[model samples]
Target: MNHDGHAKNSRTAYTHLLWWFLFAQGGVIAAILVPIHVLVQGILGPLGIVRVVDRHYDTWIRIVGNPIVKLYLLVLIAVPFFHFAHRLRYLLVDLGVPAARSVPAQVIFYGGAVVITAVTIWVLLTTVPISFG
Candidate 1:
Protein backbone atom coordinates (compact mmCIF):
# COMPACT_ATOMS: atom_id res chain seq x y z
CA MET A 1 0.00 0.00 0.00
CA ASN A 2 1.08 3.55 -0.68
CA HIS A 3 0.37 4.55 2.90
CA ASP A 4 2.50 1.76 4.30
CA GLY A 5 5.35 2.70 2.01
CA HIS A 6 5.15 6.34 3.04
CA ALA A 7 5.14 5.45 6.73
CA LYS A 8 8.14 3.21 6.37
CA ASN A 9 9.98 5.87 4.40
CA SER A 10 9.30 8.43 7.08
CA ARG A 11 10.57 6.16 9.81
CA THR A 12 13.74 5.42 7.84
CA ALA A 13 14.28 9.10 7.19
CA TYR A 14 13.89 9.93 10.87
CA THR A 15 16.30 7.23 11.91
CA HIS A 16 18.86 8.45 9.38
CA LEU A 17 18.44 11.99 10.63
CA LEU A 18 19.05 10.90 14.21
CA TRP A 19 22.18 9.02 13.17
CA TRP A 20 23.50 12.03 11.28
CA PHE A 21 22.88 14.32 14.22
CA LEU A 22 24.70 12.06 16.63
CA PHE A 23 27.59 11.61 14.21
CA ALA A 24 27.85 15.36 13.69
CA GLN A 25 27.85 16.02 17.41
CA GLY A 26 30.47 13.36 18.02
CA GLY A 27 32.61 14.70 15.19
CA VAL A 28 32.44 18.22 16.55
CA ILE A 29 33.44 17.06 20.01
CA ALA A 30 36.32 15.10 18.56
CA ALA A 31 37.46 18.07 16.49
CA ILE A 32 37.54 20.28 19.54
CA LEU A 33 39.16 17.76 21.86
CA VAL A 34 41.77 16.41 19.47
CA PRO A 35 43.55 19.71 19.03
CA ILE A 36 43.47 20.62 22.69
CA HIS A 37 44.55 17.15 23.68
CA VAL A 38 47.47 17.26 21.30
CA LEU A 39 48.52 20.69 22.48
CA VAL A 40 48.43 19.74 26.12
CA GLN A 41 50.35 16.56 25.58
CA GLY A 42 52.93 18.31 23.48
CA ILE A 43 53.48 20.99 26.08
CA LEU A 44 53.78 18.52 28.88
CA GLY A 45 56.15 16.27 26.99
CA PRO A 46 58.65 19.00 26.16
CA LEU A 47 58.74 20.34 29.69
CA GLY A 48 59.04 16.83 31.10
CA ILE A 49 56.13 17.80 33.34
CA VAL A 50 54.30 14.57 32.53
CA ARG A 51 55.49 11.36 31.00
CA VAL A 52 53.33 9.36 28.59
CA VAL A 53 52.72 6.62 31.15
CA ASP A 54 51.76 9.02 33.91
CA ARG A 55 49.71 11.17 31.56
CA HIS A 56 47.12 8.47 30.99
CA TYR A 57 46.02 8.22 34.60
CA ASP A 58 46.50 11.95 35.26
CA THR A 59 44.39 12.96 32.27
CA TRP A 60 41.64 10.56 33.22
CA ILE A 61 41.35 11.92 36.73
CA ARG A 62 41.49 15.56 35.63
CA ILE A 63 38.81 15.18 33.00
CA VAL A 64 36.51 13.07 35.17
CA GLY A 65 36.78 15.55 37.99
CA ASN A 66 35.75 18.59 35.97
CA PRO A 67 32.01 19.10 35.67
CA ILE A 68 32.07 20.19 32.04
CA VAL A 69 34.37 17.33 31.11
CA LYS A 70 32.17 14.85 32.91
CA LEU A 71 29.11 16.14 31.04
CA TYR A 72 30.87 15.70 27.69
CA LEU A 73 31.95 12.22 28.76
CA LEU A 74 28.37 11.30 29.59
CA VAL A 75 27.20 12.47 26.19
CA LEU A 76 29.99 10.55 24.48
CA ILE A 77 29.17 7.36 26.32
CA ALA A 78 25.42 7.55 25.77
CA VAL A 79 25.39 8.46 22.12
CA PRO A 80 27.90 5.83 21.01
CA PHE A 81 26.26 3.08 23.04
CA PHE A 82 22.83 3.69 21.54
CA HIS A 83 24.24 4.14 18.07
CA PHE A 84 26.13 0.85 18.22
CA ALA A 85 23.17 -0.97 19.68
CA HIS A 86 20.96 0.20 16.86
CA ARG A 87 23.50 -0.88 14.30
CA LEU A 88 23.87 -4.25 15.97
CA ARG A 89 20.12 -4.77 15.92
CA TYR A 90 20.03 -4.06 12.22
CA LEU A 91 22.85 -6.52 11.64
CA LEU A 92 21.12 -9.24 13.62
CA VAL A 93 17.91 -8.71 11.75
CA ASP A 94 19.71 -8.84 8.42
CA LEU A 95 21.38 -12.08 9.41
CA GLY A 96 17.99 -13.82 9.48
CA VAL A 97 17.01 -13.40 13.08
CA PRO A 98 13.22 -13.57 13.38
CA ALA A 99 11.43 -10.30 13.95
CA ALA A 100 10.25 -11.46 17.36
CA ARG A 101 13.74 -12.33 18.52
CA SER A 102 15.27 -9.23 16.96
CA VAL A 103 12.80 -6.97 18.70
CA PRO A 104 13.60 -8.37 22.13
CA ALA A 105 17.32 -8.36 21.41
CA GLN A 106 17.15 -4.71 20.43
CA VAL A 107 15.21 -3.87 23.54
CA ILE A 108 17.65 -5.67 25.79
CA PHE A 109 20.64 -4.02 24.12
CA TYR A 110 19.15 -0.56 24.59
CA GLY A 111 18.13 -1.29 28.15
CA GLY A 112 21.62 -2.44 29.03
CA ALA A 113 23.17 0.63 27.47
CA VAL A 114 20.82 2.83 29.51
CA VAL A 115 21.70 1.02 32.71
CA ILE A 116 25.42 1.33 32.01
CA THR A 117 25.09 5.02 31.24
CA ALA A 118 23.25 5.64 34.50
CA VAL A 119 25.84 3.76 36.49
CA THR A 120 28.67 5.68 34.82
CA ILE A 121 27.02 9.01 35.57
CA TRP A 122 26.44 8.06 39.17
CA VAL A 123 30.01 6.97 39.66
CA LEU A 124 31.40 10.14 38.10
CA LEU A 125 29.09 12.36 40.13
CA THR A 126 29.74 10.80 43.52
CA THR A 127 33.42 10.06 43.24
CA VAL A 128 34.55 13.40 41.89
CA PRO A 129 34.97 16.05 44.55
CA ILE A 130 33.43 19.41 43.80
CA SER A 131 35.68 22.34 44.53
CA PHE A 132 32.92 24.94 44.62
CA GLY A 133 30.88 23.29 47.36
Candidate 2:
Protein backbone atom coordinates (compact mmCIF):
# COMPACT_ATOMS: atom_id res chain seq x y z
CA MET A 1 0.00 0.00 0.00
CA ASN A 2 1.29 3.42 -0.96
CA HIS A 3 1.55 6.05 1.77
CA ASP A 4 -0.62 8.80 0.44
CA GLY A 5 -2.94 11.61 1.55
CA HIS A 6 -5.94 9.56 0.40
CA ALA A 7 -5.05 6.84 2.87
CA LYS A 8 -4.88 9.41 5.65
CA ASN A 9 -8.31 10.67 4.72
CA SER A 10 -9.63 7.14 4.77
CA ARG A 11 -8.24 6.69 8.26
CA THR A 12 -10.01 9.81 9.41
CA ALA A 13 -13.29 8.57 7.97
CA TYR A 14 -12.77 5.25 9.70
CA THR A 15 -12.30 7.05 13.00
CA HIS A 16 -15.52 8.97 12.47
CA LEU A 17 -17.28 5.71 11.74
CA LEU A 18 -16.08 4.34 15.04
CA TRP A 19 -17.54 7.33 16.86
CA TRP A 20 -20.85 6.86 15.05
CA PHE A 21 -20.74 3.19 15.98
CA LEU A 22 -20.52 4.16 19.65
CA PHE A 23 -23.39 6.59 19.25
CA ALA A 24 -25.46 3.87 17.66
CA GLN A 25 -24.65 1.55 20.53
CA GLY A 26 -25.82 4.18 22.98
CA GLY A 27 -29.02 4.60 20.99
CA VAL A 28 -29.69 0.89 20.96
CA ILE A 29 -29.01 0.56 24.67
CA ALA A 30 -31.39 3.40 25.43
CA ALA A 31 -34.09 2.09 23.10
CA ILE A 32 -34.03 -1.41 24.54
CA LEU A 33 -33.47 -0.86 28.26
CA VAL A 34 -34.92 2.58 29.00
CA PRO A 35 -38.43 1.73 27.90
CA ILE A 36 -38.59 -1.25 30.22
CA HIS A 37 -37.15 0.84 33.00
CA VAL A 38 -39.71 3.56 32.40
CA LEU A 39 -42.53 1.06 32.07
CA VAL A 40 -41.69 -0.54 35.37
CA GLN A 41 -40.55 2.46 37.33
CA GLY A 42 -42.71 5.11 35.74
CA ILE A 43 -45.97 3.60 34.57
CA LEU A 44 -46.49 0.15 36.05
CA GLY A 45 -45.06 0.82 39.49
CA PRO A 46 -47.09 3.94 39.75
CA LEU A 47 -50.14 2.01 38.66
CA GLY A 48 -49.47 -0.52 41.48
CA ILE A 49 -48.87 -3.54 39.26
CA VAL A 50 -45.20 -3.92 40.26
CA ARG A 51 -45.61 -3.14 43.96
CA VAL A 52 -42.81 -0.77 44.88
CA VAL A 53 -42.49 -0.57 48.61
CA ASP A 54 -41.30 2.59 50.30
CA ARG A 55 -38.10 1.59 52.05
CA HIS A 56 -36.36 3.40 54.88
CA TYR A 57 -33.01 5.08 54.43
CA ASP A 58 -30.96 2.02 55.51
CA THR A 59 -32.78 -0.31 53.17
CA TRP A 60 -32.43 2.12 50.28
CA ILE A 61 -28.79 2.51 51.11
CA ARG A 62 -28.30 -1.24 51.07
CA ILE A 63 -30.02 -1.48 47.70
CA VAL A 64 -27.57 1.02 46.24
CA GLY A 65 -24.71 -0.56 48.17
CA ASN A 66 -24.53 -3.39 45.66
CA PRO A 67 -21.75 -2.84 43.11
CA ILE A 68 -23.70 -4.29 40.21
CA VAL A 69 -26.67 -2.06 40.91
CA LYS A 70 -24.47 1.02 41.05
CA LEU A 71 -22.97 0.18 37.67
CA TYR A 72 -26.38 -0.52 36.25
CA LEU A 73 -27.66 2.83 37.42
CA LEU A 74 -24.69 4.56 35.85
CA VAL A 75 -25.21 2.88 32.49
CA LEU A 76 -28.94 3.43 32.69
CA ILE A 77 -28.48 7.14 33.15
CA ALA A 78 -25.48 7.81 30.93
CA VAL A 79 -26.18 5.81 27.78
CA PRO A 80 -29.64 7.31 27.29
CA PHE A 81 -28.12 10.73 27.72
CA PHE A 82 -25.78 10.12 24.78
CA HIS A 83 -28.67 8.96 22.70
CA PHE A 84 -30.49 12.18 23.57
CA ALA A 85 -27.49 14.28 22.56
CA HIS A 86 -27.09 12.50 19.24
CA ARG A 87 -30.73 12.87 18.38
CA LEU A 88 -30.80 16.46 19.47
CA ARG A 89 -27.77 17.30 17.38
CA TYR A 90 -29.31 15.87 14.25
CA LEU A 91 -32.60 17.50 14.99
CA LEU A 92 -30.93 20.86 15.12
CA VAL A 93 -29.19 20.21 11.84
CA ASP A 94 -32.37 19.07 10.19
CA LEU A 95 -34.17 22.17 11.37
CA GLY A 96 -31.65 24.18 9.33
CA VAL A 97 -29.90 25.92 12.17
CA PRO A 98 -26.76 27.73 11.00
CA ALA A 99 -23.56 25.91 11.90
CA ALA A 100 -25.52 23.05 13.35
CA ARG A 101 -23.42 20.56 11.39
CA SER A 102 -20.12 22.14 12.34
CA VAL A 103 -17.43 20.73 14.62
CA PRO A 104 -18.47 22.89 17.52
CA ALA A 105 -21.96 21.42 17.32
CA GLN A 106 -20.53 17.95 17.62
CA VAL A 107 -18.49 19.07 20.61
CA ILE A 108 -21.45 20.71 22.28
CA PHE A 109 -23.67 17.69 21.74
CA TYR A 110 -21.25 14.96 22.81
CA GLY A 111 -19.69 17.17 25.44
CA GLY A 112 -23.09 17.50 27.07
CA ALA A 113 -23.29 13.73 27.17
CA VAL A 114 -19.86 13.52 28.74
CA VAL A 115 -20.81 16.04 31.39
CA ILE A 116 -23.97 14.14 32.18
CA THR A 117 -22.00 10.90 32.47
CA ALA A 118 -19.55 12.52 34.85
CA VAL A 119 -22.33 13.86 37.02
CA THR A 120 -23.99 10.47 37.06
CA ILE A 121 -20.75 8.80 38.12
CA TRP A 122 -20.16 11.37 40.84
CA VAL A 123 -23.66 10.94 42.19
CA LEU A 124 -23.44 7.16 42.13
CA LEU A 125 -20.05 7.03 43.83
CA THR A 126 -21.10 9.46 46.52
CA THR A 127 -24.41 7.72 47.20
CA VAL A 128 -23.40 4.07 46.97
CA PRO A 129 -20.92 2.47 49.35
CA ILE A 130 -19.97 -0.74 47.62
CA SER A 131 -17.95 -3.16 49.73
CA PHE A 132 -16.19 -6.33 48.70
CA GLY A 133 -15.89 -7.54 52.26
Candidate 3:
Protein backbone atom coordinates (compact mmCIF):
# COMPACT_ATOMS: atom_id res chain seq x y z
CA MET A 1 0.00 0.00 0.00
CA ASN A 2 3.02 2.28 0.01
CA HIS A 3 3.42 2.87 -3.71
CA ASP A 4 3.87 -0.57 -5.26
CA GLY A 5 0.53 -1.85 -3.92
CA HIS A 6 2.10 -4.36 -1.59
CA ALA A 7 2.24 -5.00 2.15
CA LYS A 8 5.54 -4.96 4.01
CA ASN A 9 6.59 -8.43 5.11
CA SER A 10 7.43 -8.05 8.76
CA ARG A 11 10.21 -10.48 9.46
CA THR A 12 10.03 -10.18 13.21
CA ALA A 13 6.29 -10.18 13.59
CA TYR A 14 5.83 -13.95 13.29
CA THR A 15 8.91 -14.61 15.32
CA HIS A 16 7.68 -12.30 18.01
CA LEU A 17 4.30 -13.98 17.85
CA LEU A 18 5.92 -17.35 18.54
CA TRP A 19 7.93 -15.99 21.44
CA TRP A 20 4.87 -14.28 22.86
CA PHE A 21 2.88 -17.49 22.58
CA LEU A 22 5.54 -19.44 24.42
CA PHE A 23 5.84 -16.69 27.01
CA ALA A 24 2.13 -16.74 27.72
CA GLN A 25 1.77 -20.53 27.78
CA GLY A 26 4.89 -20.89 29.90
CA GLY A 27 3.62 -18.32 32.34
CA VAL A 28 0.29 -20.07 32.68
CA ILE A 29 1.78 -23.56 33.01
CA ALA A 30 4.39 -22.42 35.54
CA ALA A 31 1.90 -20.51 37.60
CA ILE A 32 -0.38 -23.50 37.85
CA LEU A 33 2.24 -26.22 38.38
CA VAL A 34 5.15 -24.66 40.27
CA PRO A 35 3.33 -23.53 43.37
CA ILE A 36 1.70 -26.90 43.71
CA HIS A 37 5.08 -28.56 43.40
CA VAL A 38 6.73 -26.27 45.93
CA LEU A 39 3.93 -26.58 48.42
CA VAL A 40 3.64 -30.36 48.20
CA GLN A 41 7.33 -31.17 47.87
CA GLY A 42 8.82 -28.41 49.99
CA ILE A 43 6.47 -26.85 52.49
CA LEU A 44 3.53 -29.05 53.37
CA GLY A 45 5.20 -32.43 53.17
CA PRO A 46 8.36 -31.39 54.98
CA LEU A 47 6.36 -29.71 57.71
CA GLY A 48 4.39 -32.97 58.20
CA ILE A 49 1.25 -30.88 57.99
CA VAL A 50 -0.40 -32.52 54.97
CA ARG A 51 1.29 -35.92 55.05
CA VAL A 52 2.05 -36.42 51.37
CA VAL A 53 1.80 -40.16 50.73
CA ASP A 54 4.61 -40.34 48.16
CA ARG A 55 6.96 -38.15 50.12
CA HIS A 56 9.29 -41.02 50.97
CA TYR A 57 12.36 -41.51 48.79
CA ASP A 58 11.45 -44.94 47.43
CA THR A 59 7.88 -43.94 46.84
CA TRP A 60 9.04 -40.75 45.18
CA ILE A 61 11.26 -42.76 42.88
CA ARG A 62 8.49 -45.13 42.03
CA ILE A 63 6.11 -42.32 41.39
CA VAL A 64 8.42 -40.43 39.11
CA GLY A 65 9.28 -43.61 37.27
CA ASN A 66 5.81 -43.75 35.85
CA PRO A 67 5.55 -42.69 32.20
CA ILE A 68 2.83 -40.20 32.93
CA VAL A 69 4.84 -38.77 35.77
CA LYS A 70 7.86 -38.48 33.53
CA LEU A 71 5.82 -36.57 31.00
CA TYR A 72 4.43 -34.34 33.72
CA LEU A 73 7.87 -33.71 35.14
CA LEU A 74 9.18 -32.93 31.67
CA VAL A 75 6.43 -30.39 31.15
CA LEU A 76 6.95 -28.93 34.59
CA ILE A 77 10.69 -28.53 34.21
CA ALA A 78 10.86 -27.65 30.52
CA VAL A 79 8.10 -25.11 30.02
CA PRO A 80 9.37 -22.89 32.82
CA PHE A 81 12.73 -22.70 31.11
CA PHE A 82 11.09 -20.88 28.23
CA HIS A 83 9.22 -18.62 30.63
CA PHE A 84 12.45 -17.69 32.35
CA ALA A 85 14.26 -17.21 29.07
CA HIS A 86 11.60 -14.90 27.72
CA ARG A 87 11.54 -12.95 30.97
CA LEU A 88 15.32 -12.60 31.02
CA ARG A 89 15.43 -11.65 27.35
CA TYR A 90 12.86 -8.95 27.89
CA LEU A 91 14.52 -7.85 31.11
CA LEU A 92 17.71 -7.15 29.20
CA VAL A 93 15.79 -5.43 26.44
CA ASP A 94 13.88 -3.40 28.99
CA LEU A 95 17.17 -2.43 30.61
CA GLY A 96 18.28 -0.88 27.30
CA VAL A 97 20.17 -3.63 25.47
CA PRO A 98 18.65 -2.68 22.08
CA ALA A 99 17.54 -6.30 21.72
CA ALA A 100 13.85 -5.92 21.23
CA ARG A 101 13.93 -8.35 18.33
CA SER A 102 17.60 -9.13 18.08
CA VAL A 103 18.10 -12.54 16.51
CA PRO A 104 21.22 -13.25 18.52
CA ALA A 105 19.48 -12.57 21.78
CA GLN A 106 16.56 -14.76 20.80
CA VAL A 107 18.88 -17.54 19.68
CA ILE A 108 20.93 -17.43 22.84
CA PHE A 109 18.04 -17.34 25.26
CA TYR A 110 15.78 -19.76 23.43
CA GLY A 111 18.68 -22.05 22.65
CA GLY A 112 19.54 -22.29 26.31
CA ALA A 113 16.00 -23.27 27.07
CA VAL A 114 16.02 -25.90 24.32
CA VAL A 115 19.30 -27.37 25.52
CA ILE A 116 18.07 -27.54 29.07
CA THR A 117 14.87 -29.22 27.94
CA ALA A 118 16.79 -31.81 25.94
CA VAL A 119 19.02 -32.51 28.91
CA THR A 120 16.03 -32.92 31.11
CA ILE A 121 14.48 -35.42 28.71
CA TRP A 122 17.68 -37.37 28.37
CA VAL A 123 18.27 -37.54 32.10
CA LEU A 124 14.74 -38.57 32.78
CA LEU A 125 14.75 -41.33 30.21
CA THR A 126 18.22 -42.64 30.99
CA THR A 127 18.49 -42.29 34.73
CA VAL A 128 14.92 -42.62 35.87
CA PRO A 129 13.58 -46.10 35.35
CA ILE A 130 10.30 -46.55 33.55
CA SER A 131 9.36 -49.44 35.83
CA PHE A 132 10.95 -52.36 37.60
CA GLY A 133 8.82 -54.84 35.63
Candidate 4:
Protein backbone atom coordinates (compact mmCIF):
# COMPACT_ATOMS: atom_id res chain seq x y z
CA MET A 1 0.00 0.00 0.00
CA ASN A 2 2.84 2.35 0.87
CA HIS A 3 4.61 1.65 -2.44
CA ASP A 4 1.43 2.27 -4.35
CA GLY A 5 0.94 5.58 -2.53
CA HIS A 6 4.51 6.62 -3.37
CA ALA A 7 3.95 5.86 -7.04
CA LYS A 8 0.79 7.92 -7.10
CA ASN A 9 2.56 10.80 -5.41
CA SER A 10 5.35 10.68 -7.96
CA ARG A 11 2.89 10.79 -10.85
CA THR A 12 1.02 13.74 -9.37
CA ALA A 13 4.29 15.59 -8.83
CA TYR A 14 5.32 14.88 -12.38
CA THR A 15 2.05 16.28 -13.70
CA HIS A 16 2.50 19.50 -11.74
CA LEU A 17 6.06 19.76 -13.04
CA LEU A 18 4.83 19.43 -16.60
CA TRP A 19 2.35 22.28 -16.12
CA TRP A 20 4.99 24.55 -14.66
CA PHE A 21 7.43 23.64 -17.42
CA LEU A 22 4.97 24.63 -20.13
CA PHE A 23 4.20 27.87 -18.30
CA ALA A 24 7.90 28.71 -18.05
CA GLN A 25 8.47 28.03 -21.74
CA GLY A 26 5.50 30.18 -22.68
CA GLY A 27 6.67 32.99 -20.42
CA VAL A 28 10.15 32.95 -21.88
CA ILE A 29 8.94 32.97 -25.46
CA ALA A 30 6.47 35.78 -24.74
CA ALA A 31 9.07 37.89 -23.02
CA ILE A 32 11.57 37.50 -25.83
CA LEU A 33 9.38 37.76 -28.91
CA VAL A 34 6.24 39.73 -28.00
CA PRO A 35 8.01 43.02 -27.51
CA ILE A 36 9.84 42.71 -30.79
CA HIS A 37 6.58 41.91 -32.56
CA VAL A 38 4.80 44.85 -30.97
CA LEU A 39 7.63 47.26 -31.65
CA VAL A 40 8.00 46.38 -35.32
CA GLN A 41 4.39 45.90 -36.36
CA GLY A 42 2.47 47.97 -33.84
CA ILE A 43 4.78 50.91 -33.21
CA LEU A 44 7.24 51.30 -36.04
CA GLY A 45 4.83 50.53 -38.88
CA PRO A 46 2.11 52.84 -37.58
CA LEU A 47 4.62 55.60 -36.86
CA GLY A 48 6.12 55.33 -40.37
CA ILE A 49 9.52 54.48 -38.93
CA VAL A 50 9.46 51.14 -40.75
CA ARG A 51 7.31 52.20 -43.72
CA VAL A 52 4.69 49.43 -44.04
CA VAL A 53 2.99 51.05 -47.06
CA ASP A 54 2.63 47.82 -49.05
CA ARG A 55 1.04 45.88 -46.22
CA HIS A 56 -2.26 45.41 -47.99
CA TYR A 57 -4.51 42.34 -48.06
CA ASP A 58 -2.78 40.67 -51.03
CA THR A 59 0.64 41.06 -49.45
CA TRP A 60 -0.62 39.28 -46.34
CA ILE A 61 -2.26 36.59 -48.45
CA ARG A 62 1.02 35.74 -50.14
CA ILE A 63 2.89 35.89 -46.84
CA VAL A 64 0.47 33.50 -45.19
CA GLY A 65 0.68 31.17 -48.19
CA ASN A 66 4.22 30.22 -47.21
CA PRO A 67 4.16 27.18 -44.93
CA ILE A 68 7.16 28.48 -43.00
CA VAL A 69 5.42 31.80 -42.40
CA LYS A 70 2.29 29.98 -41.31
CA LEU A 71 4.28 27.98 -38.79
CA TYR A 72 5.94 31.10 -37.49
CA LEU A 73 2.58 32.80 -37.09
CA LEU A 74 1.30 29.73 -35.26
CA VAL A 75 4.18 29.95 -32.82
CA LEU A 76 3.71 33.69 -32.42
CA ILE A 77 0.02 33.41 -31.59
CA ALA A 78 0.01 30.15 -29.61
CA VAL A 79 2.95 30.72 -27.30
CA PRO A 80 1.87 34.16 -26.14
CA PHE A 81 -1.65 32.87 -25.64
CA PHE A 82 -0.34 30.15 -23.34
CA HIS A 83 1.75 32.75 -21.58
CA PHE A 84 -1.38 34.80 -20.95
CA ALA A 85 -3.19 31.74 -19.61
CA HIS A 86 -0.40 30.85 -17.24
CA ARG A 87 -0.13 34.37 -15.93
CA LEU A 88 -3.87 34.71 -15.49
CA ARG A 89 -4.06 31.43 -13.60
CA TYR A 90 -1.45 32.50 -11.08
CA LEU A 91 -2.85 35.98 -10.83
CA LEU A 92 -6.27 34.66 -9.88
CA VAL A 93 -4.75 32.30 -7.38
CA ASP A 94 -2.74 35.11 -5.84
CA LEU A 95 -5.77 37.34 -5.68
CA GLY A 96 -7.38 34.91 -3.23
CA VAL A 97 -9.92 33.37 -5.55
CA PRO A 98 -10.95 30.22 -3.73
CA ALA A 99 -11.42 28.18 -6.88
CA ALA A 100 -8.17 29.23 -8.43
CA ARG A 101 -6.07 26.97 -6.23
CA SER A 102 -7.95 23.83 -7.15
CA VAL A 103 -7.26 21.16 -9.78
CA PRO A 104 -10.35 22.32 -11.67
CA ALA A 105 -8.83 25.76 -11.84
CA GLN A 106 -5.74 24.42 -13.52
CA VAL A 107 -7.94 22.56 -15.94
CA ILE A 108 -10.05 25.61 -16.64
CA PHE A 109 -7.08 27.85 -17.27
CA TYR A 110 -4.69 25.47 -19.02
CA GLY A 111 -7.56 23.79 -20.81
CA GLY A 112 -8.28 27.16 -22.35
CA ALA A 113 -4.77 27.19 -23.73
CA VAL A 114 -5.29 23.70 -25.14
CA VAL A 115 -8.52 24.78 -26.78
CA ILE A 116 -6.91 27.84 -28.31
CA THR A 117 -4.06 25.73 -29.60
CA ALA A 118 -6.45 23.27 -31.20
CA VAL A 119 -8.39 26.07 -32.89
CA THR A 120 -5.17 27.63 -34.14
CA ILE A 121 -3.99 24.34 -35.58
CA TRP A 122 -7.33 23.70 -37.20
CA VAL A 123 -7.53 27.14 -38.76
CA LEU A 124 -3.98 26.96 -40.02
CA LEU A 125 -4.38 23.49 -41.51
CA THR A 126 -7.69 24.20 -43.22
CA THR A 127 -7.29 27.83 -44.18
CA VAL A 128 -3.67 27.87 -45.24
CA PRO A 129 -4.33 25.12 -47.77
CA ILE A 130 -7.46 26.80 -49.06
CA SER A 131 -5.75 30.15 -49.20
CA PHE A 132 -2.90 28.79 -51.31
CA GLY A 133 -5.04 27.01 -53.95
User: Which number leads on TM-score?
Assistant: 2
Alpha-carbon TM-score of each model against the true structure: 0.55, 0.80, 0.77, 0.78
Single out the weakest 10-residue window by summed lDDT for candidate 1. Answer: 51-60
State each candidate's clash count: 0, 0, 0, 0
Please say which candidate is ahead in lDDT: 2 or 4: 2
Order of quality (TM-score): 2, 4, 3, 1
* Stretches of candidate 2 exceeding 4 Å from the true structure: 1-4, 12-15, 53-58
lDDT of 4 by residue, 1-133 (tens): 2376766655656666776787777878888878987887788887888766335666756777778877877787776676788788779878988788688987888889989888988887776453443
Off by over 4 Å in 1: 1-59, 99-102
lDDT tens digits, residue span 44-124, model 2 = 877777664222466667777778888988888887777788788889878888687788998998889889999989998
Instruction: Candidate 3: give its CA RMSD in angstroms.
Output: 3.8
Minimal lDDT window, size 10, model 2: 51-60
Query: What Cα-based lDDT does every candidate model obtain?
Result: 0.65, 0.77, 0.82, 0.75
Candidate 3 or 2, higher TM-score: 2
- The per-prediction CA RMSD against the true structure, in angstroms, equals 6.2, 3.6, 3.8, 3.4
Please give the TM-score that candidate 4 achieves against the real structure: 0.78
lDDT, ranked from best to worst: 3, 2, 4, 1
